[model samples]
Target: MNLKTKLFGEVYQFGSVKEVLAKANEEKSGDKLAGIAAENALERIAAKEVLSQLTIADLRNNPVVDYDEDEVTRVIQDAVNEKIYNEVKNWTIADLREYIIGLDTGDLELKRISRGLTSEVIAGVTKLMSTLDLVHTAKKLEITATCNTTIGKKGTLATRLQPNHTTDDIEGIELSLYEGLSYGMGDAVLGLNPVDDSIDSVSRIYTLFDEVKNKWEIPTQTCVLAHVTTVMECIKRGVPVDLVFQSIAGSQKGNEAFGFNDKIIEEAYELALKEGTAFGPNVMYFETGQGSELSSDAHHGADQLVMEARCYGYAKKYNPYLVNTVVGFIGPEYLYNSKQVIRAGLEDHFMGKLTGISMGVDICHTNHMKTDANDLEILATLLGAAEVNYVIGVPGGDDIMLNYQTPSYQDDATLRSLFNRHPIKEFEEWMEKMGLIENGKYTERFGDASIFFGK
Candidate 1:
């Protein structure tokens, strides 16, 4: 079978990719059973392999190649297909890299093609060696969480001002948003995963943020990851909802862990569409992670990474504006340490990006794991380099309610500076106008701290 990926609009025919993942996840799933899944998987893997082949040297060298991205993609595909059919094993990463240098692609398509090509390489290679399969929920991962940037939005390093509001106190919630935003955290959206799921609490949240957004003239979207039922009621009551939020698992039972079913998911997605969005055409924002299936005993014998990628397939049904893969937030049971965290971050990012979801990474860790801020920093910067759409820019990189550390506001600034990235265009302009940022950098590291303290 064939399908066009979301971002690059590349058509892919996978053959080995699905089989490798399935075989890795479930030792019994063979090529015959993989069928269409393998074909889909192969396309993504080939894209990554092809992307890895194109080097800066190749670009800088102006190698004797013409600009034919499609042909370059097809060459990589042909080699991968041959391998998937067990016809050859001659094409290595080195061979593919050298081959890509000969392609004639334009500057615009180079990054897009390169990004699409580079995404799925990690997970495919892991299958040849030791598979990073899921383990039993040996230990409980801290469940303090959390997208609503915009659909079809590009050229911006986006982030959500994610603040966990445990209580229904409007003032407390406002302060969190204000603080995070003051620090340049609210670049694309102000999304909150509320602990209080009460109807009144959820309703108050929509009202509070909407009022705050207007009063403060913050040009961004907002979402509350509440029950679809509550959000639907809020919609019925004429409350604003910029994006629909849900936690989905690859396996059915895993979704049951969060009290979600496909019917409810579809209903919420459809309902949000009626409410309209502040940004692009999409109204859904889904959050996913590895180990949710295994942790909830819903993996259905698929490898965790495969299961994670499968969740993106589910998200695509709604055409989400943002799909965030919280790589390390699930704890160490699935991803042991920083190295595992970094690898998972890359794997999650590539899978999401390859699948064509405007992807982001949390790259965070709870106290339960053997990780620190530095580990998250590495993943964040790497994701930044990968041209991911958004990240979680928390205050001080610490989420008090979730008990985890994400890249802080300053880290976002540092990445933006390093990559020469700007926030969502209108947001960048607003920040510069408001003095929250200066010359595309944050105005205050502590985020207008003196104002919060009345200094």
Candidate 2:
């Protein structure tokens, strides 16, 4: 309840829990744009100092939005295991941070601790962690989910092969898809970000994905990243939908901005379970990013980091197979440059893992952002080191449709080899069976899209 701290012979007092959370965050353009960020470095540290002393119960009791007013807050609060919550309710934020990073802590204990944490507490502790701290703690946790294949195995990394075309050209998409698969990509899912989200266009793309998946007997899932409604309609029409995709937000208002409520998301999940084509209990794919709520004017005075973490809390209820933060796609207003982008990629991956979800990252940047391939490669290497469940793979790290740069097909292969990691076990075997790999290296057929055409 006390939001005051002394630093450098000055008293820094924040107005409320919201203010403290916002001020303690590392510099972000979105927070500055919102006019809620700390005015100076000393004030930022003061906020962190004050935030570290707050109790878990204090954060839980003061949900970012009133529980009655926001379904997101309700979902986060209602999901907390009360017994587990009680065990850590009195722990200070600093204590929670050290406990997580402590030498004695490992995957199982972290999972247990995750169940008791609200998204606010997660954000609070994250604000106090250094970049390496995020990586070290995240690397210690193992979170995996099964759709067609299990992902996030300790020695494995995965990629979502995004074969997007500027004009929804099936041939172009096919060419890109074949190229990506030849490089041993698409173990997570052969998902496309359609230039067209219409029913006809979306359905046609899904049909293509289905046919290719069946024809090659690829040991992976497929999807078109259309809106949830269009995807639900496709499923209702008996289209092959291995996974349901949606871009979700942290607050109910923000979700509304995305044109969905919990009801729609629940309906989509139920429909996928009853009618979709995946093999598992996990079949949802969610995308979240920092600054989305602020962009939509739905942040409700909370920092983007807290809002981002709430996204994980909301996604947790549905048990998504893939939940990736499109880390740098929201432009420089939210993430600014390379340093902030890399920091957010690590933060999101770490938070998603701690929230008990299979998390990935789209290590990306837009054209106008002060970033380039070098920055993205640095981030990809860091996430690779953190043992992320997956990262997005486009043909050349450029989504012609979305107009952003992500990891390329070659980048994914290099990451796996560099880390001595493999794709999902089944996909790896399939690649081996197809002679795409030998002696743990790509064979002569690698990068040849023509191979899938039997030429």
Query: Which numbered prediction scores highest in TM-score against the true structure?
Result: 2
State residue 147's C-alpha deviation in candidate 1, in Å: 11
What residue runs in model 1 are displaced by over 4 Å at the alpha carbon? 1-155, 276-279, 441-446, 449-455
Model 2: which residue pairs collide? none
Task: Report the alpha-carbon TM-score of model 2 versus the true structure.
Answer: 0.99
Candidate 2 structure quality by residue, lDDT tens digits, 1-455: 78898898999988889899999999999999999999989999999999999999988898889999999999999999999999999999999999999956499989998899999999999999999999889999889899999999999999999999999999999989899999999999999988889999999999999999899999999889999999999999989999999999999999999999999999999999989999879999999999999999999999999999999999999999999999999999999999999999999999999999999999999999999999999998888889999998997788989999998999889999999999999999999988999877889998887888879
TM-score of each: 0.70, 0.99
lDDT of each: 0.59, 0.93
Cα lDDT of model 1 overall? 0.59
Candidate 1: 10-residue stretch with minimal lDDT: 135-144
Question: In model 2, which range of ten residues has the least summed lDDT?
Answer: 97-106
CA displacement after TM-score superposition, residue 157 of candidate 1 (Å): 1.1
Q: Clashes in each model (backbone N, CA, C under 3 Å)?
A: 10, 0
